[model samples]
Target: MIRAAAKNHKDVLVVVDSQDYPRLLEFLQGNQDDQEFRMMLAWKAFQHSGLYDCAVSEWLWKQPTVGGEYPLSFAVPLSLKSSLRYGENPHQTAAVYVDKRLSEVNAGGIASAIQHHGKEMSFNNYLDADAAWNCVRDFNNPTCVIVKHTNPCGVASRDDIIEAYRLAVKADPVSAFLGYTASTIVDPVGGVGGIWLIWDPTQVSVSAHIANSQLIQATVKRENFKEWVLAAVYASPNPGIRQNLWNDLENTSSLMVRPWLIAGTILPIS
Candidate 1:
């Protein structure tokens, strides 16, 4: 992520996915209203430039550890993705930025995720989410990963998806307060589980959310559950992700079936 050449002004229109060509054309034809889509495109345009600028800085940072002198001035330009209520504390200010390079190469990850439902994510939320996302991807079987404060509170991979999730939380029920869950098994088959039956990973889940304290539990509803075989049940920890309880789940859940993308949520220590 290197220059602000792709920056978007107030009057500009930006679209990255070619699949949106039909939608863009339709929007131009005045067939519908997509104010939210317009805003998101403008945001992506700025991120394009931010990625370029950050690319330059990323190169500079690498030099120091590679026997080269550090740059006289150093800076990283990241496009703001979301703003946290606070940083590590209430008095501090913090926000999350999208990695333009990562977005360009692959548009699925914690940073570029689509939030199905959740409260405003905190900085620590991002950290723990990142941890959970990576841990689940580490397996190729029906798996579940539970994370707390950026640590692997629990992780299990089993032939049975429900059992996997149960074992993960049971690994540390006290710390099993999951804000999100993930896995990478394609053709992830399923039988009757506790709440629902999920037979295929490709079908769209009819989410019948059972919202907990701060999270909306995933309870996929279908007129014919046996036919669709699509189900997803999300859960969360105590109450601030331990306080907020249930929050943030879409990223890892949506990414579960996308096999092309193996791993990308390695947040920088800085």
Candidate 2:
């Protein structure tokens, strides 16, 4: 029996009641390519981390398979962590965490991602991006979203990915030019010309590029369900930023004032 309750069954795989740390590591190292081996590895990882034992599981429903579907489907478990985003306000702070398993079968291939650049994402960035991407990702076409503060200044869905860019530009060209453009989370490609950013608190100017307008290629609305959200605590204090600061702040929400914005959707005033 594949016991998911790690806290309850911590000793199930234990040899002679020992924690078996080495054995655990060995097991993971071995049979890495085997589908069944991967499943076991996933369970063991969850058990060791206490996610299945101490943490709550999400998206825990069963589904049918293809061709009138057999009852057997994957019970994949995915995890999520909510980090501190400077807070609801720069002064106020908050956090939200979840353990959502995206699948239950074929465990060996799962892995987490690491950010190489940009400012740290905040609670609002997650929420707004979740909402923003959810709206555009299903288009079976490429789309672009310009988010100011946390609200959607521009969201365009079309057959041509460029058209999506044009729509976003048309919605709020001024804000779109300054705001962040997030792709999808599952995107193998890290949106360079158009993507999210991290606000450097020390420097006043946010990191960006002038040629981002040129690299856009393809026109798609097929919706791959990948996306990202972006925001800077504040714009760069550079002369270029200074010119747009008022408009950026006025057009976009204030991280200091408004902790988050759900682009393309209504946000309740706190």
Candidate 3:
């Protein structure tokens, strides 16, 4: 109506009753060029034809059931866990929350993952890690699953962790760089360019214990700390230096570590 009035270069008048007059007046405030017509045409028509009363009576008769009759009409209980570093992108803000009922039944999922190493986990990292972890956990043998944008790009199972990794990478070599790997063992010597590591600490128990001590010492000795942007620890470390390791890494490195505790086990990785 406003556009038509502007195009025709003429004033437009709107007719409304007392009930709708205020709203119409507010809408046409700056645009009004003529006086408004006030009339209760609708009310007079309904009074004579009884259309409004019949419609109201029909609506009341067909009213839907509520509360007790429809148990699905209930609110879910949720508790805010923590704020994520950012959402899928840096400009957006996001947070993690847990459903009270679901968390009680499945307590070992991503909602309980701790940050033990790099920067705070981003929303995308949590999603990718969750996907990779779920796939790797399903296999009994040594398995490697690489996830990118919440989809598995490469997945393979073998007796040997290294062979499994190689086979997984062979699935899609090009996408391997832009993905996060969930595996029993990740070769640290491999190019760490775009590949993010989500390693199981239990798989490298012996070496992880030694690496824990070495990592602390390396942090102390090296003047330049390398940043592993996408690396996450999804398994618990040795109990002896758990606190010490977390403190040292927090103090020394620019990298973020996510310490996950699953089924009463603390998974610490750097």
Candidate 4:
């Protein structure tokens, strides 16, 4: 109706119920002319087109509703969990939500993943699954990725998923069991309260140790993080000291370090 009025180069009056007139008037307000009317019509048309295309089309894998709220329906109620990391930084909050109906239907009525069992999910768990599950989906062989925050602490692929899980867990066992295993300094003994282990049934362990674990997150995504292992550590020494040492090393590129420097290096020393 708005388009028709705009095309005729006339004032567009959208008359609905008296109660809706206030809402309608809120949509259009400006010093008016045919040009302005046409522009308004075009903008409205574009928005409507985008809504139908992105929000209502068959290609929409995820749905976004008005006011950013996904309505809960009997057919598709959502299950949610809060994440450990805030947004992209240490302070920003985040969470994950899945449609319980779709999950149950797709997984053959098996509620294999129970998020309420123990520890809450974290941003890194979602991120880790984003990296690991895709890898699990791609190959007949099993694969695993230990992620610290969004980066891979350790990743490996093996015929047996359990072996892969062992390799992933061993990468930085002290940190691996914690939420941000590779990035955070987890208490060596105390913080092992809950560790989320996401895996297929073949890789699932039933031992008391595995049962005592805090959380085990499991999912399937294509193209896993089996080969993208981050180095053991990402810390850098003082830049000035490092640069000077680098310059000295470059000048004596072939020089071998004495036993003292090597011996002085901490292994047993902190």
**Alpha-carbon RMSD, each predicted model:** 17.1, 16.9, 19.0, 18.0
Off by over 4 Å in 1: 1-77, 178-270
lDDT, residue 64, candidate 4: 48
TM-score quality measure for candidate 3: 0.37
Best by lDDT: 1
Q: Quote the positional error of residue 9 for candidate 4 in Å.
A: 36
Task: Estimate the TM-score of every prediction.
Answer: 0.41, 0.36, 0.37, 0.31
How far out, in Å, is residue 184 in model 2? 24
Q: Which tens-of-lDDT digit does each residue in 1-270 have in candidate 2? A: 334433334333422224556755777577543444344544565555544433332223222332233324333334445455446555556664443433244221212233467656665656666666656656666788777666777887788888888778888856764433443221112111122332323333322311121111111122353232233222222444344534544554432342332221111212
Q: Positional deviation of 70 in candidate 4, in angstroms? A: 23
**Candidate 2 Cα errors over 4 Å, as ranges:** 1-82, 95-100, 103-116, 177-270
Segments of candidate 3 deviating more than 4 angstroms: 1-71, 100-108, 137-140, 178-270
Best by TM-score: 1
Q: lDDT scores for all predictions?
A: 0.55, 0.44, 0.53, 0.43
Residue by residue across 1-270, what tens digits does model 4's lDDT show? 534543454445433225545545655664444455445555555444444454444334344443334433213334453345445444468766664546646651222245555445556555666665555556566788776666667777898888998887877665575423221121111122223333233433222111111111122232442221111111123453334433543443254332111101111211
Better of 3 and 4 by TM-score: 3
Q: Provide the lowest-lDDT 10-residue window in model 2.
A: 210-219
Order by lDDT, highest first: 1, 3, 2, 4
Q: What lDDT does model 2 reach? A: 0.44
Better model by TM-score: candidate 1 vs candidate 4: 1
